[model samples]
Target chain A: MTSTATSGTTSPEPRGPRSPGRPRSERAEKAIIEATLELLGEHGYAALAIEAIAAKAGVGKTTIYRRWPNKEELVLDALAATSVPLGELPGTSLRDDLIACVEYVRRSRGSRSTRLFPLMMLEGLNNPRLRERYETVVLEPRREVLRGVLRRGIEAGELPPDFDVDLGVALIVGPILYLTKVWNVPDDQLPDDVAARIVDSVLDGIRARR
Target chain B: MTSTATSGTTSPEPRGPRSPGRPRSERAEKAIIEATLELLGEHGYAALAIEAIAAKAGVGKTTIYRRWPNKEELVLDALAATSVPLGELPGTSLRDDLIACVEYVRRSRGSRSTRLFPLMMLEGLNNPRLRERYETVVLEPRREVLRGVLRRGIEAGELPPDFDVDLGVALIVGPILYLTKVWNVPDDQLPDDVAARIVDSVLDGIRARR
Candidate 1:
């Protein structure tokens, strides 16, 4: 479905660059997205309204509606602007790759990741459109990146022969999600050995017998 | 300021028992509390209105307001009904306690605990009044139940010497919260060994280096 030819030929989203003009005022766009995130942090996702965002951005609600259809869609666009692109990592071990993943979460969301993310999560629970956008755009993209590194590990005989790469990925990172988002103690709240503690359990079976 | 004492010294409220008349209907009180939980489960704390609950229960809103002042207070009462009373285990090892804990989660919230509980957690996140009520009514009660077992385990040398009991609780239950509230996966979708995996990790550690 994604395969397409550029320009004159049929393309779903036009793979090649379009002939552009000034490109929608990058500074204004950035400011609007930043305002949306800040509001999500302070007021939470449910309380957020487009009228409030437009007011905070010093733009009209019409301007926001002109750009994005509704609050969830606007949140999608705003989130897209701020999230890490989940691209490549080093050819190093799985440890390094996982480190990069946690580091990405830290850098992208900053200290507020633990605080603001639950709002998005809880909102996703309530809103179908937001949930779709969250799963597709926000979550899958990151999962895909980690899956690539795991796939490489499988071929190289680094991971166990029957290791479920996907579950392994989840196992490695799942603690971070649970600790930060649920408990609110956060990964950052732990002593320095927390990451190492996590790595231990995932690699070795936790059974005292094992 | 919970000293609205009736005959009991521990009266946290003027919920003064058995007003000297036709003995306030036990049937009415049970039906009201049940209706409140049902509404809370169906429509969450914010959407739950006193008028609606009273109408549903075939009682006056004054009856409800007489028992509880506001939605927040009523929700707290409703939460108390839903939360499992703790210290029901066989008094064995930490594993037994944990298994009991997981079982308690199931009994308290049913198999769908994760989905239903998010409403409470998210509301607590946003509402400070709810936070105090939450800790007083739910979190602390449960923790206190487990605390005795953990102390016994420490004496008997089951859990590690340095184990953080509160953090341990969070870690053990954290993934359930993540999968339910953040990942929005159905509770029946829980991986089979999930509880075991978390328990093992806690009793041991996750780190390969450690």
Candidate 2:
């Protein structure tokens, strides 16, 4: 299938000499990203091939090449496309809001992510460009959202004015990540009330109150 | 050079007929495990070769084959040998005890661990035996220590009777693991007071007290 990039009405008409091919289309971009994720799950980083990605995507090899120089770049872009925005959670309290964020991560992480996320983390260590992009595009955005929530809570006097927001965020989210990745706890086996439990434990530490 | 595992006074005299050559020596076993860790640091899991490990350790390939069925098993054993026993920390308070544990991990994880930990985690996912040994030998032992500390804290009335000990342990250790591995944050860059701050954050949450 020869997928072509179609220019939407918002795209300005070509002012200069255009490439002798169809305009780029959002449909093809989404297809390529989805294909990259599927291939990553099945084959991992070492075996992922551009030709296979193009074939699975149902687009010409040139379509992928024009956008990404190599499989690493392609994979980075594919992951970035899946990054969720965490700005609009609806909850009556900080505890509920935190749970909402955890659920969002749970729901958004596809099966492919279960197998592929670790590979990307390992691969990113050796490759500087990939590491930077993984942090900036994939990690930092989600962290910023958490920060935003904490800041809001502090301002509303829901939290202490001197609260260490950064550490607060880490305490809230870190255990879930550790259990999932390090301990290899399957999602189903994870405690049903993990989010609530984490919030409670962190909010009121094991230390006895006066 | 070919090495052998020799029986010592510690080993009971062989009841059955033994091989003609010298018994497997404990010295050669230690050498081989050390070599495996060094190679893992330099080449990671995919490129690690049993032959190279044998050569580096100055033992015969047969020596490695006799003990471990494959590279993964050998690597797992090498890591297991390095797991620290956390039983003797001399801290006056639960907070001090937790920090000591954190410091012990920070000190014990060598450069090899920094390079090799992620590879082991990624490889362990597909290999169930390695994963099981990883949990039993490497992960669970450390987790058990944290459990012991929390239990001790509760017994002394340092913490509330109803405190969630399991979640408390996770909250204590999870952020450090997450920052080090997932974010790939350099050890030097981690705050010196991380343990104290985590302890504080969990004890008295960011939430403003009534």
Candidate 3:
């Protein structure tokens, strides 16, 4: 968890006014992020308060404020911490490439992520700043991996030359979002066959023998 | 909207309340619902408060509480108010039936609904109460309309009897939600072609030219 960076700098002396230090306590930062995610899941974004987060983390208000400019920024950092990183692009066929992403989401079901994500989305409604961070940290990184897979597909000519990269990205991401958000697929029953099914259906279409 | 029904009240004037000759004002009820929708659009659910809504509508807290039990319920009521009622089963083809639903959703964009729908989705994150209401109020009604259309198509032999109805429903709703939620399709540009393409793809799979 980037311990080298933390260990590189001697943990700073408590600063007066400006609060001099080698950045802040890495332990305190980790604790604060965990507390923020817990608070978000438990109380939701509307009820989540910075003072409560600081108190829960056993850090001062200034410590919390110094690290993150606003509650949204704090929440953004917390969300980034809890988010499941995009798994390595699977080195198999198109099927395996797709499975990697779906499995990654399936494994995240019971975690704080399930609850925190929607709250972050809710917060995004009013907070432009939160929306920006969400796009940058969680969303863009995921899209990049998907884009790589598409680039490979097009190069291999497995998919049509003119296949819409962006559309394919949506087609891949859409069913999972539909499953999690609207359909509320049960935790155990998330279809492992889903990615294969989507690729099949999207590439092939459902029409029967003429 | 339907104030009396939305309030969940036996009578407009409560037995516990004093001096209720004129009872509650329907004007105030409509105003409050309108204000809630407006604020939800302007500030979203997290920033939307009963107090803010009351101030906008020139009503007291008691008035809002009397009509709805809580913020969740109040939001649901306002959402229901804006939702285009899922009309009766269309006697047309499944494609036409789906087109009708898409058109209704498209027309609702930029009204109170486009803004409020996302908030309802956000609320469904952790609140089982809200989730149940979401399925019943928002998700099921729309899904059922599509389901019925598919059911009829199966019965009429237009579609295969063993065709996956649930998946068919997914096909219909999936792209629309993905379009709005992630892709940020312009409010005016619902892309009827996308809806048509989705319908064609779902019914006829996307195999390469013979």
Candidate 4:
């Protein structure tokens, strides 16, 4: 079955710029990722099988192996694709940038990928390899983006020079995550002004000054 | 096997007030709960079985069924036992109470039951029954504790009378959870003063007083 698909990739089809169709390899990769995510959501990390993913993707095991060396890498790529990119942060004030970051989290609450996140983390408790890859590939990159914004805030004198960047990132992202992930609050119930409210509250503090 | 265990319970043993030994039913109940927790940590909620738990506890399925109607209830009771009780809060100031709450979370980070929390929540995502039971039994009770603290603060004018109790709870608990649960930060690296710092920061705010 693998050989059949491998042969198909190398078939003597017309190879020219005029061919409007997408490259077969790219198509196959997309299918593999889509199938991996679908299977992951349905069965979770422990029960997912490579053969099942390959069969569901209508590709060959050889094709999958040729692209990704293992299931973890495949799962990583699929998850990475689903993470909502922070995109270009507006070179505005720290409040705006922080609000943007919280907004990103709020938007992510509605995605299918966000739903699978807890499951992946749950599996990570028992599977160290997957956890490490997820941290480096998915978590670290997102955290770095937020960290950069905080660093800029310090540079611009928007935040105190002695600010704790790591805690700051956690403060900005944590409440929203707790709401969406742990509480599993529905999108409708989550206030539209929550991002602004969190940013303002974290900035001004919650105490009632005398 | 169940019949034997059930019969053992009703055997013509002398009901003497002078009996020094613990009651037979109480001993069986304790063993059953212990076995349930052990299995939950090892196999997760999905794979846990009543028969396996009974066998491991040296009790019969009948004995378990007589105490708890189903696995969810049994699991809830087992989990409730493991949760660290927040006994007798220091009724000094809101800062102290909030810090104590955060400290409770920090201390809980080290327990075996805390490790199983994510796995149970992950399973809860797919199992509505489990999710509902967990919300009512575990999460809601804890949240109520925090909310009560926030409510008292509001009433005392430490916070504005219109303070959002729910969001306040999220802000206080969110960052530490992000560190322990999401980032999987090690206990050794978690600073001793973190609870105080988080509580103080949330109360004082993070923005530079420009």
Candidate 5:
């Protein structure tokens, strides 16, 4: 496996023979992550139990415990593995990049993992440890990706140098989240060009006039 | 007592000796509502139990049942009783009124009931009945209040006649919610002038400059 290949510095033939247990362990890990996500979507964070996850994954509790110390870490891994990365931006223009980010959010509305986001937030309200991990592991990375785009906009003189990047992120992200999470606007009901509309509206307010 | 007064059309004197059951029933109702809010804050919606609420309130389950048909309705009442209505707008300018609306949201940050909003939203995701009731009972009223403000702004020619009020509301409300709910920005960390900042930012985008 990749793990063995990366770890074997002195091995003459890294790919010669896979360990008998390696493939089964990898399958178990995937099953565990899938079960974690399914339970979270059905029940939510507080009600999620490690034993239940083991049962659903058809693995022993010790296998799950060996992989993740607790439910939070397991959940964090599941989210990280499943989350759609921002991917390569077109580098065309600020408006295009912003539209891409919003479109990413719009597309996530259909996924079960995306639906668990609010439940995770609810649990984070009470658990500081999980909250910190979630921020650093899941949320901050996504925000940084968007921040990079905004930074490019500023450097290129597409936006004012004094533009607040954090506020800009909130402005672009907030309305769509409100529509999907709070308003529970159905997918079919959402405008096809919502990403463009939001990006343009925010761009008009933030972009400096020539 | 108001219920008694409103229903006593045949009574010669509406203020005559109060029904003994009425005052005690009112007190029981108050206790139940308090317990509901407390448990909801502590455990969230999915974990909330009517039996537990009754136990906490020092009343029988039947007492709670008599007043509210189910946990959702009880929660709706508890939220309604505690929710801060947008009392009256200044009607001075679109900028001022929007600031007031945003300020209202800012002030709600300190309330326990306000904290339960995300939990309620999480529950609403799965339960269509609860979602509809929450929208009609709690969310719609607040949206309507903000909607009224936007309507006035359009009428006063401060905004374009074609202004998208729903979109305007989403733009103004979304960032603030994102800051408080998603980012979990602490109260002290949030600027005192956040309301003004958000309103001005959104107004600049939506309002038609002369």
Candidate 6:
């Protein structure tokens, strides 16, 4: 269910000409990504500097720049690491799939990475570069995964063929977002049952009225 | 439908012994509130300071401290100023009422004051004081207005007596917030028709399925 290419490819790779030196250090790359998320979670995007990320990652500044051309690119990759690929959910029906999706958010709502979402939204408000990267890197990819679920549901005859996919998607995802972000509902309380209710409610609208 | 009396009173007034020579200045009070909102919009709550607000308002620090005693109270008041009292929306049916409610958000979404919501959400995450004050001053009051509308809908036989009011509210408001804030869709593009669509979809599930 996860969109695979959505994460890594969107960043504008200003990767400078590679020097004929030691092969790219995967270990160093991993450290850098982890440190970037940690710092982003702690201080948000504006306060984040590549120099600080290099220090935290214990990699040289040159190595950091070699991989990601800018801070936006670096943060994009870091956020990508934190997100689960929307792989196929273990569900026989759209209702189950929807519950799985909501459960995924519920599980992650407490983590430092998830907590960074509010700050990410804050940073995106003022920074156009970060906002574009965020759409490509974070927002669009997640939306794509959900899009797939809805498309499949329609194909499987679980939903009406003529349903407005855009509005349907909003109806499905909107309340969960409201609960998590606006109401600040606790992670434990965002039950699978509520996800089921939302799915039923959305389906009632778009389902063929018998 | 806006909640009243949710602002102003929540703050603990550590009003120090007043100097008998001068009554509190209403002009200073107004300036302080305005300055707090301006700075909150520009720098966000994390960067906002009482000292900066006092300087911006051209009032003494003690004047601010006298009424609110802390930044949270000042911010709550500033946020309160931005929200309009829930005026009686002219509508007959529950669907009409719901549409009117959504239209209110649509109208205000582009304002400088409403734009502060994302920033306020970000600040509330780290600061419990602000979060509580926000709930009291901003979120709860707005919610109460919607609650009344929903209750009236139920009583009027427009919706099921046992309708999940909370979930219904979220469903109604969520997509609007998602569209306005998350997607940052253009103001002119957010049509009045959307309100009707959301109401129709919500009514489908909760309305007596005929």
Candidate closest to the true structure, highest DockQ: 6
Query: Considering only chain B, what TM-score does candidate 1 achieve?
Result: 0.72
Q: List DockQ, one per candidate, in order.
A: 0.31, 0.38, 0.34, 0.44, 0.48, 0.49
What TM-score does candidate 4 get on C-alpha atoms? 0.86
lDDT of 3 by residue, A100-137 (tens): 76566556655666556656655666775766677776
Score chain B of candidate 6 by TM-score: 0.82
Candidate 4 — what's its lDDT? 0.79
Better of 2 and 5 by TM-score: 5
Q: lDDT tens string, model 3, B115-155?
A: 56656666666467777876776567667777888888889
Which ranges of candidate 1 are over 4 A from the true structure? A1-24, A31-72, A83-93, A96-129, A145-158, A186-189, A204-210, B1-25, B34-71, B84-93, B103-116, B144-150, B187-189, B201-210
B143-169: candidate 5 lDDT, tens digit per residue:
888899899888988788988788788
> lDDT by residue for model 2 over A50-82, one digit each (tens)?
899899889988767666666766787677666
In model 6, what lDDT does residue A30 have? 78
Candidate 4 wrong stretches, greater than 4 Å: A1-22, A206-210, B1-22, B206-210
For every model in order, the TM-score on chain A comes to 0.71, 0.74, 0.77, 0.85, 0.82, 0.81
Clashing pairs in 6: A1-A86, A1-A87, A1-A88, A2-A85, A2-A86, A2-A87, B1-B86, B2-B86
Error of 2 at B154 (Å): 2.0
Displacement of residue A206 (Cα, Å) in model 1 is 6.4
In order, candidate lDDTs are: 0.60, 0.69, 0.67, 0.79, 0.78, 0.74
Off by more than 4 A, model 6? A1-24, A84-87, A190-192, A208-210, B1-24, B190-192, B208-210
B63-181 in candidate 1: lDDT tens per residue?
66666666776666666655556546877677878767755653444422334456666576668678666667656676667676677777877666776666555555654544444
Minimum summed lDDT over a 10-residue window in model 5 chain B is located at: B1-10
| lDDT string, candidate 5, A93-165, tens digits | 9989999898888777766667777778778778878888888777888889899999999999888888778
lDDT of 6 by residue, B11-126 (tens): 35533333454445667877998999989877777788989999999987876776675787778877877675557977677777888888887777766657777777767777
